[model samples]
Target: MKETFVILARHGATEWNRISRYQGHLDAPLSEEGLEQSRALAGALAALPIKAVYTSPLSRARICAEMVAAQHGLAVTSLPGLIEICHGEWEGMLLSEVEVRYADLIRQWRTYPYTVRMPKGESLVEVEERSWAALEFMAAAHPGEISLAVTHDTPIRTILRRILNLDQAVFWQIKLDNTGINVLGCRQGRWRVIALNDTCHLGGWLKAGEQMAL
Candidate 1:
């Protein structure tokens, strides 16, 4: 049974992230704090034998991947499957605004994400399928080695759910901070989650007032 280590990281914070706006597929540049966070993450991962790095095409994720890859002298391969779930009309809205317009749907999303689909957007099931496929592709491509996959919140959550074999209804139970790391060990199609939302690398830089979203 050959073992492969998959390190999952959420992209660093963006202005939208600071304002608590829904990023979804919208492109947002990393904030100054975000750059610092990426540097911290890169430093933390410098000791690992990262064979390759993969990222979503979105700038936030791509920037994070590039930072980490540079430390290990690995180029990043962007994969569309790792892009964030499209939030349709909610892409730029704040959570409070979403609550005002789609109260019931927002409730369903927080409580039972699998039961509600975003208007003109994707369902949790759809996100899970594509993200799981991305993970499987990485595992097959880098057997017996360690790889880094940098993506967004929803996609990371979907991958974690699949790796843990958890129901989609439990989606909101997970919390992933900006630049947070999740470790998964895969062998022969089986996975064991070693860590979830590990942000110790951020040191005291993780501000208590910072907001996070999915």
Candidate 2:
């Protein structure tokens, strides 16, 4: 069987991201520094033979997918299932604010994520289910080829946890940086992670102060 390579990337930084706010399903445009990060990511993947680019319907992820796909003369295909985990009531709130209002729940989320479902939001299990469906569809559609998927932190983390065969309670252990690249290979029905959260392409901007804590 031919091997398939999937490049998973989180969208670039946003104003909310800089302030440590929960974007969830909310939309936030990329900041000036974010535009640079997208460009750098585009350049980094320019040499690859990316057959398709998938993105969340949200602008933050769509923009980054566009930047990278444009380099290969490909159009980005929006996948709603790839959207960020809905934070619902916690949307737009800073981490500190969430800590104050939902302290116990927040602690549960940190310590036992699978047990703490966000108020009015989807759970990590939901994210994992939908995200895996989307990814499996993409992988099947583009066998033996390279493809890109631009998404958000939680969705990416959920997918990573599933791919690694880990429990959702350990979800926080995976850290994905903005515009970070993760490479996964699938061959003969087996999946292997080749790289995780690679930011070497954005060394210049990261050094210049576009660092993101999440």
Candidate 3:
């Protein structure tokens, strides 16, 4: 059976996003703009027949997933495999700081994204292995259903690269804007990329509200 997909969206921005910090495992709430982005994305997917919703466990991804799931009156299912690649010791460090300390390692990691792991982060191969396994799991569980997977930018983007058989070196070249929707599908145990990064949901530039814990 062919599993049709409507949209797969990355979570909105967070506080760490503004500072360009490595939020590997640092769980933080979304900023005002992030919430607006989520609402806008939910509006984008409202016209589609979203059968189910999958989300990463982190706050940023979860919040975004929940927002969209609520629009469809469906509960968001947590998938550990969709979680961000853990950055370990550098979870909350600034990108510039890390670059200064681990210059060569950082360069190699960026250039050869598939094999290099940060000092304590996961390798691209490790992330791909788990993400592909998770995709297979979703495919088996929800056959022929149009669904959504709301996850972190890194993992979602990596999944796109792997499924498209693109060069790992160009992973970052496919930028996933805040609340972007990248679509993929599963037909007969195989995956196909329908769309890369999309952000038409946000309409135009949007300003966020004040930070209030929800």
TM-score to native of every candidate shown: 0.95, 0.94, 0.90
Order by lDDT, highest first: 1, 2, 3
lDDT of 1 by residue, 100-210 (tens): 999888888889888878999898889889998998899899999999999988888888887778887888788788999999998777899998888888763355244
| Tens-place lDDT digits, model 2, residues 1-214 | 8899889999988988888888888888999978989999999999999999999999999999999999999999999989998887888888899989998988888889887678899888898889988888889999999999999888788877877899766777776888999998999878888999898998833553432223
Off by over 4 Å in 1: 204-212
Model 2, stretches more than 4 Å misplaced? 204-214
Q: Which lDDT values do the candidates have, in the order given?
A: 0.88, 0.87, 0.77
Q: Is candidate 1 or candidate 2 better by lDDT?
A: 1
Give one digit per residue, the lDDT tens place, for model 3 in 24-52.
66787899988988898988888888888
Per-residue error (Å), model 2, residue 210? 11
On TM-score, the stronger of 1 and 2 is 1
Q: In model 3, which runs have C-alpha deviations exceeding 4 angstroms?
A: 204-214
lDDT of 1: 0.88
